[model samples]
Target chain A: MEEFEPKIVAFCCHYCAYSAADLAGSMRLQYPPNIRIVEMPCSGTIDHRVILDAFEKGADGVYVAGCMEGDCHFLKGNYRAKKRVNYVKKVLAEIGLESERLEFFNLSAAMGPRFAEIANEMTERIKKLGPSPLRRKGEEK
Target chain B: MIVAQQKPLEEIARLINDCQKVLLVGCAGCVTVCLAGGEKETEFLASALRIKRQLEGNPLETVTFTCTRQCDPEYLLPLDNLIGDVDAVVSLACGVGVQYIAERYPHKWVVPALDTKFAGGSLEQGVWAERCGLCGNCILHLTGGICPVIRCSKSILNGPCGGSQDGKCEIARDVDCAWQLIYDRMKALGKLERLMEIMPPKDWSTARDGGPRRAVREDVIIDA
Candidate 1:
């Protein structure tokens, strides 16, 4: 049995999470490299289709990083993203995946350390869960 | 509009689990406006079902299509070529779409993904409230646009029953008294005098009591 290396997809908002990622890089913050970040104009644009599509495409874990409460660049984009994340969690459970495989985090662009923390936290969670159930027999690596 | 809500994903998956491949159809009509069934939803469900089956070691193939309106015959004709070879069909439209698909392709299995709720309008971004009873009669002129038939718990025709309290129905605190809305609107319009006339019992025949109903316009008929 080979080691299970999880594939995690991160949907990051341009106004906050994306900038926070840039700051994390500049600050020399260390985090897991498993996550593949997809930049978005706003977390509010997160669609259930896209999140589910990630799982369908063999993402072992997924997360949406948005602005903190009451600090969204578009007034309530993070709030809207929170609602959509909660919704997709239920659907993931229905599809036999642990709802914990999906998550939503709120942060500000200045919170570089916090961004690294979220990445480490999500990585640990996915590592414990192993590969996604949909991962084919010989593809977990 | 016919408001609807999607059924849980587990139940929908169970309905089509025996099939190897299926078509997931969406309607661009009322269900779309209600955010229940649309092109996006159709693709989402197809993906969810595929993931569910794949997790179980049984891969499911899905084809998706969005019809203009499933209830109309012409709008459904495009599916003639798309329905081939699928073991079953999952419709995300309202109940009407499910039944229409079943009738059109009698040899194939048809499943409904939405629970047809009511003939109503959107109350807010994601909320909907029933506003009409579809009783085959026009009574809005008498009730000042507030329909006591569907809005009222008892469907009282003439006056508010004793269940009304503080502008709310006794059945639930969240339910507004339909008669209260009628009174407020009529008074605002200075049409309170109209309420003074003793109303007669409604003729039940015009409603569903007459059995399945149909409406036809001879002028619009075209020889086939």
Candidate 2:
């Protein structure tokens, strides 16, 4: 059997997580290639619809990465994003999806190692969870 | 504004279980300001319903529409052309909007997604508190803008009921005694003497007990 490669969507805030992702690449960090990053001015800009749309569009896992607590470029955008992510988790559970498929992570722009670790960790988590039921049957992984 | 809350997701999913196609109608009026049945909430519910149905192997097709105000006949007219295309309509508006839509489309199944809460305003972000009883009567002048009909658990017209203790109602410790609020406000404004005056028995005819009431302005009416 071919190894399952889960599709993951990561919403990265430009001031922090996005920069971290870039640093990870420059540092030659070995992370799973499954993560598809969507850059945003702030993680707070990611709405519930955008998160659900990622899952509906066949993402096995989704995570919003924002700045560390009290370290957001915008004073409280990370805090707002954290609250929204929690709300989306409840909504996902209500919709019969595993809440574990969605997550929120906080990191500083210098945390390249942490970004790679999160990418690898989320890939492994999704791999264990298997494909999303919303994914069309017999579709490629 | 009229405050309302969305029904639980489980109940909503069950309500439309047999439906294959549904029009999720949202109101841009009171429900929107209250954060219950607004455009964002409408889309959220639509996505939730679709996800639930799709997971159950019964995919649902939902079309979302937000009217300027569902309670108005003029705004609801836009739905006339689209009403026949769907099996049912899940309205995320308040009770008035739901009833208006149902009345407008007698043949279509109109299900309410929200439970009409009260005539209220936001106390803070995401927190709404009932402020008016809509009794077709105004008594705020005597109560210092604090409404006993709503804030008071027993709706006592004269003063705080016996259940009021330590400025809180007996029903719940967190609920402030409405009369206490009124008294404090009136005292601050040097209008405590007004409370000493006896108020006549309220006219009940204008209240809900009178049955459906209508407000007519003859001067504004034009015969068609």
Candidate 3:
């Protein structure tokens, strides 16, 4: 049996998380390549439909990484994203999707190592959860 | 405005589980103002249901539409073409919208995706508090704009009910004693003397006990 490689989508805010990912790349920090990073102007732009659509289209795990609390570029964008992520987690839970499969994180652009750490952390979590139940039969891991 | 809440995703999925295709109707009336049913919500629910069904291996097809006001006949007439192929309809509007769709498309199964909550106003974004009891009468004038019929835990017309303490109801710490609010409001308006006049019991016939009521405006009717 081939080892299961989980497909993860990371919604990275341009001001913080996305820049952090860039810093991590420059710093040469090692992290699992199982995750996909989607850059957004602000994490506050994340929508419930888009996140759920990720799972519907076959993402095993998803997370929104934003600026630290009280540190959003648009004043309260990260706070808005945090609330939205929690709400979507509840919706996922209601549909029998493990709420743990979704997460929200806050960090500054300077946290290069932390960005890599989160990538590795999400990879292990999804690996443990196995493939999403929504994934069709005989599809890629 | 009438406030409503969306039903749980699991329950909505169960309602149309047997069908391969469904029409999710949203209303742009009271339900829209309350954030329960509107174009965005209707689309979101359709996506969620499709995901649920796909996971179940049944693969559902969903068509979403938002009506100007599902409670009115004219708003639902445009759905006639879309109704032809659907096995069922999931109405995201209030209970009135569900019945309207069901009545319009008599041959198809229709279900409600929202729990019609109350006649209320938005306290803030994502929060709503009830304000009216729909008693078919106006009484706010005497109560200084405070309504004990709905705000009061027990609907006490002339009372602090001995359960009011520190301006809060005995039912819960957050619930304000309606009479207490009325007393304060009335006192501020120099109408404290009005409370001394022994008020009679309300007429229950004007309320729900009167059965389903209707209002006819002959001036607005055009004989066809």
Candidate 4:
């Protein structure tokens, strides 16, 4: 049987994570194929709904990758994104969903290797968690 | 504006349990202005619910709709098409909007996502205070524009009671005694004479005591 492939959605800040992903590609650094990146002008622009929507659309894990705290292109965009992630985590917990499914990471545009590391780390974490319980697979309410 | 707070997240989650399709409805009226039941809140709730369902193994589908004013029947008509396949509606509107939906769609299950608080406004970003008492009477002129009914701990019509000390109410340390505020303001404005005149007892007949209230303007009436 094929292993459960966790669908991870990564909301990447255009100035950092996206650039880092591009740099990783240029550097020939291979990462997990599970992560699907959605580029945004700033990580702060990624509303809580967008992350939740990714999960709703069958993503087993969601990530918001922004610039390193002081490195955010929009000054405090990454900070706002961080605050939102914390709030979403609480919301996820209240709904009985593991807060671990949503994550935020900071990396500089030049950190191609670090970007790949995150991709691998998040992928491994979700793999161990298996399919999301919300998948409507087994059991009755 | 009427300010309300979202119901406890856990309670809201339980209300939508077992539903395969849910509509998270938001209102753009008072709720939207107060940031309690607006499009953003709808998105937050829909996302949370979706994640919850996914984790529960029953992954339910959800759609979002925001109306200008859910309390009005006309505003909700547009949602007729959206409700066709949804099993339940999670209303992020005030109590009036929830009742309006329940009244219009007798067969559909309507769940309230917010706890109806009061006719108030935001004191700051996240803090809201009760401002209107809806007492069916207006006496702001006599009270120096501060409403004792809603602001005072005792709603005293006469003046500040003995419990008032150093401009704060004895009941709650943080609360500024409403009558004390009125006294200070009136004294400042040379309107202290207004306080000497006793107000006739408030006749609440026009309020909830009158069963229900209605207002009709004869000049604006149109025969349908």
Candidate with the greatest lDDT versus the true structure: 2
Q: Which sequence of candidate numbers ranks them by DockQ, best first?
A: 1, 2, 4, 3
Compose the digit string of candidate 4's lDDT tens values, residues B1-224. 88899988778878988689998899999999888999999988888777666666777788999999998899999889999999999999999999999999999999999999999888886788998888888878789999998888877788789999999999888999999999999999998998999877778786677787887899988889
lDDT of 2 by residue, B1-224 (tens): 99999999999999988899999999999999998889999998998899999999999999999999998899998888778879899999999999999999998999999999999899899999888888889999889999988788888889877888999999999999999999999999999999999778888788998999999999999999
Tens digits of per-residue lDDT, candidate 3, B72-118, equal 99999889989899999999999999999988888999999999999
DockQ of each: 0.85, 0.83, 0.56, 0.61
lDDT of each residue in A1-141, candidate 4, tens digit only: 767778898999999999999999999999999999999999999787777777666778999999998988889999999999998888878888778988999998999999999999999999998776666564221
Preferred candidate (TM-score higher): 1 or 4: 1
Please, what are the lDDT tens digits per residue for candidate 1 over residues A82-118? 9999998988887888999999999999999999999
Q: Please give the distance, in angstroms, between residue B47's alpha carbon in candidate 1 and its true position after superposition.
A: 1.3
Q: Candidate 3: list runs displaced more than 4 Å.
A: A1-3
Candidate 1 lDDT, tens digit per residue, B57-129?
8899999999999999788898999899999999999988999999999999999999999999988998999
Q: Write the per-residue lDDT of candidate 3 for residues A23-112, one digit (tens) a residue.
A: 999999999998899999999999888898899889999999999998999999999999999998988877677899999999999999
CAPRI quality of model 2? high
lDDT of each: 0.91, 0.93, 0.91, 0.88
Worst 10 residues of 4 chain A by lDDT: A132-141
- Listing candidates in order, what is each one's chain A TM-score? 0.96, 0.98, 0.98, 0.95
Error of 3 at B42 (Å): 2.2
